[model samples]
Target: MPILPRVALLLAACLAPATLAAAPDRAPQDVSGRVLRATGTTTSGEGIPGIAVSNGIDIVRTDAQGRYRLAAGAGQTVFVVKPPGYRFAEAADGLPAFWRTVPADRTAGAMAIDFTLVAEDRPAVSAPEVLLFTDSQVKSARDIDYYRRDIVEPIIGRHPAALGVTLGDLVDDQVQLYAALNAVTVRLGVPWFHVPGNHDVDPGSTGDAASLATWGATYGPDTYAVEEGDAAFVFLDDVVVRPGGTGYVGGLREDQFRFLGNYLAQLPRERLLVLGMHIPVFDTGGRETFRGADRARLFALLKDRPKVLLLSGHSHVQQHYWHAAKDGWQGAAPLHEYNVGAACGAFWSGAPDAQGIPDATMADGTPNGYAVLSLRSGGGYALAYHPARLAAGTQAFTPAMALHAPRVLRRGAYPAWGVFANVFMGDAGTRVEYRVDGGDWLPMRRVERADPRLLVENVADDVATALRGFDRSPEAVPPTHLWRGALPTDLAVGEHRVEVRAFDRWQGEAVAATTYSLQEAGP
Candidate 1:
């Protein structure tokens, strides 16, 4: 049977029943379209030599011209899944690129569902909403069950558009957990995509070749793109592990880098780019180090782009940094890097909650929380932190203390000095205070513009002195304190004092004081 004639016959047979069931006034329906690479200035790619199409059940590979004719009942949804080494543009809302519809009439001619599979820049469609998850380091089937119940179920309940992306650490080196995790997540009624994290790698395996073979077999690809709505998403394998190595480092191989360069080159410069990886591109604290070479190369590729949002999960803490021209990138707009918190919630090692979720906190002292990012059209996004194990109305911070300046620093002579305080589980709207020596107490600036889970209290002063009384212990949680104002100018060298007091949203206040000494100017 000839291809076109055969398709015509198949269409007729499939729509005959639908035509009879519908009112004469109603149109008989079916859809047909060619899948092609999205090429230069074109919405569709020219028919490629070979490709496949499926109507969510029946599957057909495209012919030499990248065209596939599939039979569908009226109103049935049809979509094309890109083969290995190929990708579609990300949708506006960060979804896999797919088009759907209900078939009209079979004889109405095949509905042209042309696919433009470009070798380079792909179109990103906009989705209504997307869910982002990071660090599902499930070490055992039990862990997998926990993730499914605690994290996956809640997200699916929301019925988000499409599925979600796991930022990495999908497994804890068990390798077998991949299947269990997928089995649970795939039931969310949407497709789930993943990136590779350090924990996902096999420490016993060496080189990209061996590890990637295992990874690709379990996960679709090491790197790929999908368009949901109008946004483009690039998932990269940043977790580079050496065979026989227990610890992993962040690096992108030459091939991956080349692929990214090619992919980015073809994309519309104005479109939004959401790059997800296992490790962060930038590190804030001195405690957690960054892969300088890896980051530098990645940044170099991104330097030309105007709107790029980097999403990473390795830090296991929630942090947001906006960089315009840091570390030698010439990006037109500032790049926003969001470090999503771990799903294991401090490696599932912290205090267990009522549901048995562990209290996972990163080493740098940031609380464990996932991030919700809304990628908007025209290159912008809003990020919010959702703390794990906490209900919507939970208060994260409590302020403590009030300060009186002059009474503490009366004998000291100096220009200005500062005070420091702390907050216990600080949240939005907590307040603090500062004062000058023997002066009236005044409200101090809140470090965080909005509510924050933690509060940092500091004071400004001149005369230095050691305030007596309160015992300070390194192991003890710092007292949330408020500071009394500025110190006096010019005084005999001696001991002076400063104090900090903090106020919690729920609790009252507490004070902590520190003293410093002033010395005469050296000759």
Candidate 2:
């Protein structure tokens, strides 16, 4: 198949899915045009010494004069490693002013890039809350308008935390919409960071080298790191375009690994490490979409860190996976990877509601929304899901979920109707219980399967006389947080209420209810 057709099929099928060794002692490589001179300065124009800067493969620090040189390749990005007690200069839209991209054409010339750092007011900060948005795949003017009115407005419902991140796919293929998306993000009133998704790549490019040129121009470095408080956050570009733009693979380049290794070594052993990327590091349902070697290398690097959280966004569905000895993680406890849900749920499909926002519920029945991650000042962290529509103003206390069950069943029928609930933020340890007609609380089985609610929606759209929505939502994918239980059919005839309550591992709870009727068969 042609590249475009293949891309479309991939989208229809699955929506789909560094470096740096030896910063301290090894001497910087001397290449004629490969070197870049980077200076760290404060807003007052004073030289800020001791700031670490990287070229995605090597790590170096500014000297007493606040100047350092990095050996960089063409199309590489050199970003400042944000130090504690200071922040980076931010644009009006709150994107950190921290990186500069080396031109792709100049494979061997030296360039100068300067970074300005602003001192933090609090001197010390241990706990910080970050807003995480993934796969905002907004396409066309209408999508942009919908995003602003729906996703953006609810996210900044109140003054959010000081920092935020968009894991990728800020705009659907049109890179031109980046500015418009940025305009909405600025409303959140915090510095936001980004990663590159497969959609963000420049398909015109021949290979991975130049595929991110446009993205680099719009979002600074495709790979870089920054510090907020006790946490060190690394944003990486893991979408590698194929040789002829056929498709992209999910893995890290040698340069990114080198950079990551070098950068992590400089941070305190106890500091929290948060790695945000577009594609997850693990294989999903035997898809083998992600590179195992890259994941293994990453595990080796973070094996010593007691606290680590990996955040990925390419998968439209929300899931929580803990990597243990069986999954290549060598840590004492399981490594937590939160496959955050998408902002453009089901690619903005399904029927629109009274608010004119598409019911973009994800294929797994997860409502389209963003996430809030709270990092404790000490070390631990907790994450919660915020639905864009339902919990718009009240998510802090309300847990939201999609409950799927038959509305009516014959009293003599076997208990074959399964009640499926997709708790947007539930994990393996989340306690989910369902009761029929205020009966005893019965535990629901945690099942990894397609959400029945979405399956019905897919069937509805597939056979509809006239299309009733923006687009038909895609086929259901296996959900990570779905719970199921067969409803009791041996009941007296009449209407009965079914209620489900899910308590997340963090003690956050949400309740949902529906009514089912039991009827006696007529002779």
Candidate 3:
């Protein structure tokens, strides 16, 4: 199958564990030559026809001889979208080198850009699973090791996803640490893509475009895309730098809009369009995180057909939003946006575990982790989130939600308390129900409150006389994915097992369990 089209942008965050190991060499640069051959594979390497190449704005296919001519403005990049059944060699540092920079000085008669690819042993995939990670934001070398051990290590011989993407804030203002982090991620084998975050912007940069110099040099084009059998994935650099490079806003630059307008027009409506970025398209902190007009413009450009899914990071907590007309989304159905959990949960805060890694749960109660995106043939999709560390080895993590409840309650007393089910992947329409001791299933009410489980840590931190951990657990914030159902007061006088279940649109039904007890009312 031929790899299809669309474009994308940047990668993940950071955390810390007990050990601090340095990462490998920096990623490889362009296809060897500064002076690239554009026409004669006989010399240009552009001789292969039907290959897709782009300048982040215009996309063109190679001529009969695999030769292509693309117009890339000064400072733009020329990269080839990895077609199915093919692979690029990893640079010295293990990062796949697939792009070349178009020099700032373009007045010369002709410019050279190199793109090289080799065949892979794997067969073409009709459908692919992609891992989506974000906000590693590690500040020190210790955080790098934490990210490596806590996240990457378990995933190394484990994940078989086609490729991976990091939504942004790969590090916390520590730009120099990018190489070390890349060394950690390269172990996954699949090519990883990244975009800049507010923390990723070069502080020394004079403006928005300049802020990404370090990022672009490390990860290629701030905005680009790739095609697969089931969808077209696009990455966009949406963080706009403020004047004097002091602050930033979440939005897309004009050049991206031009690129999107041109690229989307050519996209087949039958294919899914997955846009990956660091900052979310919605407002944050009571302010417009993204420019309203730009969002409106971007939305208007995306026609109703073909399923469109947006993946983002920046808010450490996990969430989902369906943009409607009021939000300037006038599509056939409300637009679905999944605000993914941070890889460096709560900036790697919380009490250290036995392994010396922080609890790192997001303030909204989601444990720091990453997402698995399953893109099926014919434009259908499904997704699941994996908390960094799971119970024991080999057994893949299950249980769509985690259950929490009282240990023992007075028998025959007012059932004031209830069980809380934090349905990790739940949404507004997701049906979550609970039952006790083989009784009837009762629907759990969706609650926008802190998860009672995490509250214990928050309260402990507030009342403690000394530091609880290297960093305190995140202060609990009301979460949109939590559910509650009061435990019956009249239940039998012994321990009772409670069961909870939820329906995931794609993965089918998922179940979980916990226990609570009832004691005699007497003191």
Candidate 4:
């Protein structure tokens, strides 16, 4: 028995070390992966060490090898917060692009989830619905308020998944207002993007790249691209301002051109191409100029593509232009260009509404409004124009007549009276003329009256006397004519045609000619 106890003690001593050693080797239920950025072409190259990673609860940074391992519960989601100067693709609903969770069963053993960080190139996808907004141009706090109340609020209410991109003129030369503008739009509850406009550029700024840097700091990248759905969206920095200048002229830098070429080379022609920017490649207004040689080069690169949609917004008007292959453009398919209007109608000018918003009209005469492009599920898309005012009804007009005659009229005499006609837009601005049976075409005076209901009223008593053929006697001949005008005394008793031609603004002219017989009475 004593020998057995000694053997048991020896066995326990042997097993104690093994049990302790096994405990440390046992892996925890939770494990983490590292998202390391590699330089050059080699995977074994230096790892850019400190990157942030989190499994919702535990936040950790990668080690020197760009490797990070964390103790996480099974089936937990792991996401990397994109560091500054880096951006992530946004989902259709504006959610941050993220990697989904791994199933609990898949993560049972020593699991590994790793991401390769690379320099971001323009996004290339299959088909994408691009959001375009032009000329927010919020001038003041009041204007910003109006924008929030009128524009931003309504758009956010829609909850669009497509990314929102503005075409510059974001603030009206008020760089200070950018923060407020951003703050208000951020309320959109989605990732919104912006492009630099002429107003956004500081003409006196030191370097050509300075403005772009400022813009990128506020909004990511002066020009960049991302893929959504099946399309690649290419945003260009087209707002080329002269040094010490504010107005927009067209031109692109050599580097941007090269970047575009490289981006296009990586994208397949079969995929949809969408170009969004502040300035247009082709000057539709005839006042602005094309974006110089670089633009032409970019155009040449895209000319042969099957499908390309170019969106611009500097003109502050709504215009749709399609160039066909027969038009001698380079592309195999025609180019569809849409110029979105300014959010501030006419720069927020004109009369003020009850809300103190102006009835602004853009320089191109288009009212303030926004455009919505929806990608259909079955490989197509639809476009809609949403105007600010909500009007739904039909308008019509009522008609009346007026006549005049002179007091001094004789029996068997016809009177000549000045006649006037009036019409409204609803009245159709009808063409109205009158003529005596044997008289020449007498043009009637057309006047604009303020009140539609009381359009025709008597002008003169002389017109009434002339039509009645009555003598101008105070007691013998009371004025029977509706208008005051003198009658012609040379007409013999006979039937005459009183022709009245009325033409509606929309439906041309019509004639209402009738013959009336007159009988002479002894005076």
Give the top-scoring candidate (lDDT): 3
What clash count does candidate 4 reach? 44
Ranking by lDDT: 3, 2, 1, 4
lDDT of 1 by residue, 172-236 (tens): 88887776787787666555678888777765766555565445555645666654434567788
Clashes per model (N, Cα, C within 3 A): 107, 13, 33, 44
Model 3: lDDT to the true structure:
0.77
The Cα local distance difference test for each model comes to: 0.55, 0.76, 0.77, 0.53
Residue-level error in angstroms, candidate 3, position 461: 1.6
Q: Please give each candidate's TM-score.
A: 0.56, 0.84, 0.89, 0.53
lDDT of 2 by residue, 57-122 (tens): 766665434556666666667777776556667765467777776666764344666777766555
TM-score (C-alpha, index-matched) for candidate 1? 0.56
Once fitted onto the true fold, the runs of candidate 3 whose alpha carbons sit more than 4 angstroms away are 1-46, 104-107, 204-206, 391-399
**How many clashes in candidate 1?**
107
* Residue range with the least summed lDDT across 10 consecutive positions in model 4: 473-482
Query: In candidate 1, how many Å is residue 503 off?
Result: 19
Query: 2 or 3, which is superior by TM-score?
Result: 3
